[model samples]
Target: MLLKPITPCLWYDGQAKEAADYYVSIFPNSKITSVQKFNDSHKAVTDQDTGSVLTVAFELNGQPFVGLNGGPHFKFNEAVSFTIQCKDQAEIDYYWDKLGEGGDESKQRCGWLSDRFGVSWQVVPAALVELMVSSDPEKAKKTTAAMLQMKKFDIAALKAAGDS
Candidate 1:
């Protein structure tokens, strides 16, 4: 049973365990909690060999997720993404670099990146929303403009733009 009532499950062709391990390594207070394997009963339904990884249950920063070793009939796309609201530039940089490693460079824009697993992530400063929604219309516009130009968020630059 998952610790959370609703958990996001990622579908991978045969890299469920690998993906789970990679994710857990990046986030603090994260770990692979359980692993399920396919058995003879599932032979008729799945191409995976018996004893192969079926699903990996893991947690990243207390958020529960499952990686299913489903066949590659589906793929992850920009339609869905996980947002990491970082407290500072350092946090932003850490997550940006860590998750963006081995990712597709062409997909990076406005603090969004697509990792090696084809998972999309938005690594933005926690203060970005406030800056973008400021009472001052010019500040909000400038902040938004500044944000649009960067792949990885520069909090100081954003703040400067908001202040200007």
Candidate 2:
């Protein structure tokens, strides 16, 4: 049996290229592979301007993704989100700050943020999983409590909570 790669497609209202560029800039080992423009056939179906961005193929940290300029028929919501696992506090901070810039402040909570493009992202520390599943139930509970109160996760604070 052969395994095929799965790529997540993000639909945007004519901002696919812009969003893809932004994502490529922020993530390491990322780049825009291609930009497809709408043709006469697409214009007939989608009513989008011919020659406009139809899709953008890109990779982030080696993960393949496609950004489609599919118009305003759909929208991004909290139900779906991309999670960035960070190795440490510094990494968490870097991703949080970069991805959260120009984002909706009201949507920021519990390490989740909605970017300017309305895409939700979870910038979480890798240690968060271990803390949440600690063998000591009390430590896990305290760590979870601390985590719930923070918009941006603080690894040190979570560690202290677990220790306490």
Candidate 3:
């Protein structure tokens, strides 16, 4: 079967445009492709005109995404997450700093963070994936253990865990 990516849609009460623009600004190769407004067929639902957009199509790092000014029917939780694979700890730190804008901090294992957008991301090291999923279960468990202790994963730490 042919496969295509379906972008993740983020629902906001009235800040879709602002959030989309903010995300595009932070990530490379990102842009807002279209801003769709409701047609006359639909009626306004909130103080902000409902017929107007709150729905936009955008891309970040070649991945497509949508933002909608949806009412408070749904919200983000730690259950769902996005992963950013980093080349090294420095890259992880850079993303940690930039993405954490306006957001809170939780130093969990595997370099996971929640951004100002209320989006949870697991900033994993590329090498870590390789190590944690390696054929050797002992090594994998060690790496996993190391990841559990860090909010921003340290490659060296994971390696040490494997060695231990």
Top of the candidates by TM-score: 1
lDDT of 2 by residue, 109-130 (tens): 9999999999999999887789
Error of 2 at 48 (Å): 1.3
Model-by-model lDDT, in order? 0.92, 0.91, 0.76
Give lDDT: candidate 1, residue 40. Answer: 100
Q: On residues 10-116, what C-alpha lDDT tens digit does candidate 3 reach at each position?
A: 87767788888888887789888889876655564455564677588888887888888877777767788888888888888878778876776753445777777
Q: C-alpha displacement of 44 in model 3, angstroms?
A: 5.4
Clashing pairs in 1: none
In terms of lDDT, the poorest run of 10 residues in model 2 is: 1-10
Ranking by lDDT: 1, 2, 3
Query: Top model by lDDT, which number?
Result: 1
86 in model 2: Cα distance from truth in Å?
0.1
Which window of ten consecutive residues has the lowest lDDT sum in model 3?
A: 41-50
- Higher-lDDT candidate of 1 and 2: 1
**RMSD, one per candidate, in order:** 1.0, 2.5, 3.5
